[model samples]
Target: MHGDRGLTVGGPPNAQSPPSAADVRAQLDILLASPAFDVPARARRFLSYVVEETLAGRGDRIKAYAVGMEVFGRDKNFDAQNDPAVRIEAGRIRRALTHYYLAAGLSDPIIIDIPKGAYVPHFAWRTEPVTDGPAATGPPPETPAASLPPMPRKRIMWLGAGLAALATVVLLVMVFLIPSRDAPVPTAQAPMPGGPTLVVMPFADLGGSPETKIYAQGLTEEVLSQLARFKELSVLGRETSRSIPPDADAARIRRDLGVRYVLEGSVRTAEHQLRVTGRLLDAETGAVLWSQAYDEDLRVRGFFAIQDDVAQKVATAIGQPYGIIARSDERRTQAGAPEDLEAYACTLRFYGYRAALGPASHAAIRTCLERAVDRYPSYATAWAMLSMLYLDEDRFGFNPRLGSPTATQRSIEAARLANRLDPENVRGLQALMGALFFTEQPVEALRVGERAVALNPNDTELLADFGARVGQAGDHRRGMALMEQALVRNPGHSGYYNGVLAQLAYLERDYERAQLLMRQVSLEKFPLYHFVSAIIYAQLGMKSEAAEARDRFLQARPAIFEQWDREMAKRNFRPEDATLLAEGARKAGFPVADTTAAETALRTAAPQR
Candidate 1:
């Protein structure tokens, strides 16, 4: 007898006759031959094995461990949780089956589905539309009793006994197939390269107040910043790690960030006392490497001391030498009490908004800096950040309300005040360098940038930014070396950092390396990435690819070509260097205006030599 939609379910007593074993085997063969199984050889083999096992009444034995060893060539000792091969293959099979049912097997009478959260296969009869055709109008003509053959009573009894036995096996197997919660957790063996990499997750705010949240964030940043200043460690940036979900597991962290360790913490405050607890976990094993608790007065100095102590302990725990990690003496003194706390909290908020990279965020950063400076006029870091904010506005052509000239002037003034207030502040030096670079003093900018890098060679972010700026100022070799070291310290840095390296490569006339480096940049987030990609592709003589890249750039930044001169000037790129980029862009099919005219205009506007 046919099941729903003419599907022949296989089993049998004489009542509703199931499809024969031979018919089910034939359907399995058809499935195996379909395009759905056209994946890698191992995956195809895996799919075939699972289906055959289920058909042979061995479905309960189809666990991940068994599949790994049987089909994927994994060793007999393979741990399903530790090695993801089995899980990965199972996911591929599920997707392949879905693709098949949606396309090639849309009208197939039988459906085979692997339910998620378990690997067991389920078979169902596919429903088909009923038609009002003449064949269904009346009952079929009856056969004469003489023409029908009768079944033997012995054969009927044997078939009934076999069906009962098969039913009992299926029921027993179903019980054994229920998933167990005590399975081992998966562990990754891929070692983190170039020393240990750590991601500091945002601190949890247990204090339940909006004001207390600021303190938690500030504490996290303080610790992260201090830890990042060690040459022996590779630390992921706060902005990158903060995006991880609070409930994410160690496996997820390893998969997403490829870090060896994760630093997590929470803060609690009551009256004037504060408690901060932190723990470091092995990303591969989910084991706590080290943990510590800090109890202090809820004052800025207390917080700084706690951060310093924790950084030192974590470094020592991770096998870093004692003397190598910089002490927080100078920084702590420079960023002292009440006023520093308030200003630093504002700066943290400013950074949060800045990471969003929108016009509104830009405006918010300006507002935050304004308040910070207003509240603490002597806070050099706040003034330095304000300077950088203006420089960023000028460089990226953001916040057009503050015209380039006004932005440059403001940047210069803020940088001067920052440096005057704190002569040893590396951030102030960086701000001064940027402002000087934009104001047509490349020589001074290079000097200041070198000073900043000298003061804190272990600061990855500073090294990367300073390297990029100084490279633009004509010290390409030195700049590249600094950037290379920065990459070594922070391997999981954002795409923008890679883009800076790509630009340096382009300047050095290494088109191949430049093209390779550009791959790390996200074209959707940075249209300039596509523009540079177009130039590199053009230089490499890939006309079709170059044209495609150019189209994408134009689609994202429609007026970039027309605004090229203004952009170059705001970035303080040398006139000759600007001309080179413009020429390459023209060659790549960009509709850039004549740079010679802009060059002559610059010459006329310059003071007599």
Candidate 2:
């Protein structure tokens, strides 16, 4: 499997918490000092959004359970406020305001309370009646608004004093610029000091303009990159989770990613300001473990600083401080660099190609990938993507200059270069193995794929690829088992797992099964759906249908098959598969061009070659 697979879901008995009161106070102090309460340049920006949302008259309608999702654009099923870091920030926000009230306005005071079972912060005011003394000021006309209506003028005077005190606190608050007292804090328990597991979800774009999606996506990448520094945490890469739609179910995400926690947020860019809000959720129980919002003046230092801020906040909430987890060795090259920005943006479109694209479009994708590589030569993932695109081109017989050795050589080099850049990167390794296998270097392909699996013990893609190679190499039983395991990790995995299944089923003479697997995929949308279907149709007896499918495949493909001269259909693949496909095609009256060409494609497309 190329992505996280075999990840342990349940753990041993939990570690007991320390005594509650003292622990809460200590944690509260830390929380108060945390990013959510204090308005550092970046934190200030986040606070601005919170305040803006609060005042927009939209606050009253906001639901407590849904606040994070509504504010951050996370899936409704995943609550970000439950994250410990987020809760801690909320607590800190409350305490900061309380302190602000006590120290500043002695006469008039206002309190914002976060009621249980509610995600929205609630406001309350305390008042004292006025007296005849100089210390007693008449009510400010809004007398009935007081929560405590004890005495008339006497209570009003006390209320006036309290309001005065609160007024003074407001002055101090102005200087500090803290967040609202009602901000919710996410809950968190400290983890062991070493590596941790983390998932960074896509950031929501709240700039009132959908065009700002690029900025939000860029921020998500930025945050992911920032958090990758901790040698102790096995951070999930963007490629794995970035494709999850914003509205996807949390359970689906949890099952697919095999992660216990999820970090999601939003980004809003408007005028000279940028605001971001993030929350960490415990996927198992769908509780927000931590949450925070950061707003900054983009004009001053640029939004780059926010990345580091998010990293630090996440580290704090998780009880893994950035200073400790992110040692010098773990920091990735900053994403703020100009070249990285463009390349990352380009990479965002990769999934779109998989959804709807033709041969010419795939070529265009290759061109785009090449451009990305040109911008960030050391970007290992981009290189791997380019290699995958090349493989796709080859699979579709679109390789220009039919049967050109140069085409094979280009794929080999691209894969190799990608692996060299990021040795532990599974996709890169898979791409490299695929290139080698396609060129008939089975041994090397297996070795590289094995290494990729080792690097990511839980990666389903690596397992599927490994299985694919095995099946292609005549080890059907073992390969099929691996594919089954990969599917367990991600049932809804796109063509990656299914394509492998179809290939192996065909090779193993399970024509019916192959057809079933092909049908299970989102055929019209997935780029390789038709390709896999074409193989199954040709192998069975439906010659006319196979030919029609083949023609359709070719019409949208490059001209590489013009020289395909291999009799792959009669090879080590399941004999039953060959009989069924050929027989079915015969019955269906579909044309079956050169069966030899189809077989050769199957034989040569194996991961092990």
Candidate 3:
């Protein structure tokens, strides 16, 4: 029976009553009364399920299911016996047990543990006193017959065995009848403990012509890109996983990648048709999990149909191995209007602008994006790219023809428009942030940058953009951490991350470290790296290193005076920033007049009223 506040049961009512059912009850009362046993209601219910399952043992598997169904209301369409969700719930229950022991401050108490392969929980009394010998000489003098409980008879034992066997039969049937491992267990929704590893082997050329080979390469990249979007399966990188050599050992590859599964495939382009063969293998036992071949005539229908088939096959393979959370949201969707394609293509060209530095390069990118925006007025990416070009002009001193102070105002307007068009786009948000910070409106952008990160933690581009802006805004340490996370995601793409690291090294007053970074930099590969590296090394007292950086910087950027004039037009132009570049050239014994003249020109260029 139960009441509003508490309940009284007959079993083990007192601790000092010589181990009767009443005594067990009384010990439980003491445990419940203590402040140490304070657990939330949900945690308490989960804990209770564990306790009863352990006490009942093997014959009581159905009882475990009953408890789960009643507590969690999850038995519909789900078989507790074969479902992986049941096993995962058990794992969570195990962690909760550990939490209880630590949180309760139990110096000496009874303990329970759940064994693997069995859903039941087990309890053992730690507080029970140990006897020296196997049995006592005689029964207790004060023992009463009424208080003692009788042992199970042979008939009862037979009945329990029969029930246990029935439960086992049900478990076996459930395991066979279930179609997949993704079935949810009663009580809690939990993910499976493990999933498979998959690698997309490069597709073969199929003895095709040059144009066909290009199509084959595109097909190969498309498959990899789609698979990478799924978070459920571990996928090998494109660089490390293409072209599995003829003698390649699937078993060794699986072992090295720490995966239990491997996917191998080949593609052949014949006529205007594409034929593909794919096989999934259980690497541990050399068993084929699945194999299929697909043929499609692309010339009749177009390449889109073929690309769609490849994406579907990849999604199906990943879902089959890992129980069905894999999805293909990143796949491109064909737009109704042709201008969207033009805008996307333009964005790629603007991205290429990173390699091109100076007046001519920036102008070319601006022209390309301007035309794209003219064609597609609502194109989010094109507008954002245009904003970035304008912002770069002021931020990096790229537009020598336009005065810096007025150019910054122009950049601010462009960035605002970009943000207005595409608030969700990381590039757009970053462009707006740059405009705000330089225009003395950093507060909102910093807050929004942090919010953006919280929302998209896995996005490396957002992390890098946010890090650079925050570093420029003076939160050096936080900025460094954000950039480090970006590097961790894409290790080989170090151009932007390396430049930011060089700047951070300068901030910490580590001159030698700054100079070391400058030497590793390749300006031809990344022009901005050289520009930032030059200023940093120059300030760090490394004259030779600074001069090398300055020479490359000037070589890549010939319009030094005009660029300076454009930058000086921006608010909060620092003398030290120019000094770092100028003083380094002087220390390296280069003529100082050109540097000073450029600096003076920048300072003098103000927007007309």
Best by TM-score: 1
Q: Pick the candidate with the highest lDDT.
A: 1
Candidate 2, after superposition: displacement of residue 161 in Å?
Answer: 64
Ranking by lDDT: 1, 3, 2
Q: Give the TM-score of candidate 3.
A: 0.40
Among all windows of 10 consecutive residues in model 1, the one with the lowest summed lDDT is 183-192
Residues 315-402 of candidate 3: C-alpha lDDT, one tens digit per residue: 4454421122211111111223233244444554454465344566788778777765554443444555666677666566665344
lDDT of 3: 0.54
* lDDT of each residue in 1-609, candidate 1, tens digit only: 222223223312232333334444444555654433324446667766877788788999999988888897788778898888787667756755765676656655456777877776776545432322344456545867645543332233335445545744553354234322211111211111123457888888998455568777877887776666543355776766678898998878876556667888888878777777878777878877567787777565665576665554443333221122111211332365333244445555454443335456667767767775654444566778788888766666567543334677777777776776567677788789888987778788888988877766555656777888877776677778778866765554556667777887887889899988999877656665788888888888989989999998787567766767776765667665776777778889999876554476557768865
The estimated TM-scores of all candidates read 0.44, 0.42, 0.40
Candidate 1 or 2, higher lDDT?
A: 1
Two-way TM-score contest, 1 vs 2, winner: 1
Q: Candidate 2 at residue 526, lDDT? A: 55
Q: How well does model 2 score by local distance difference test?
A: 0.53
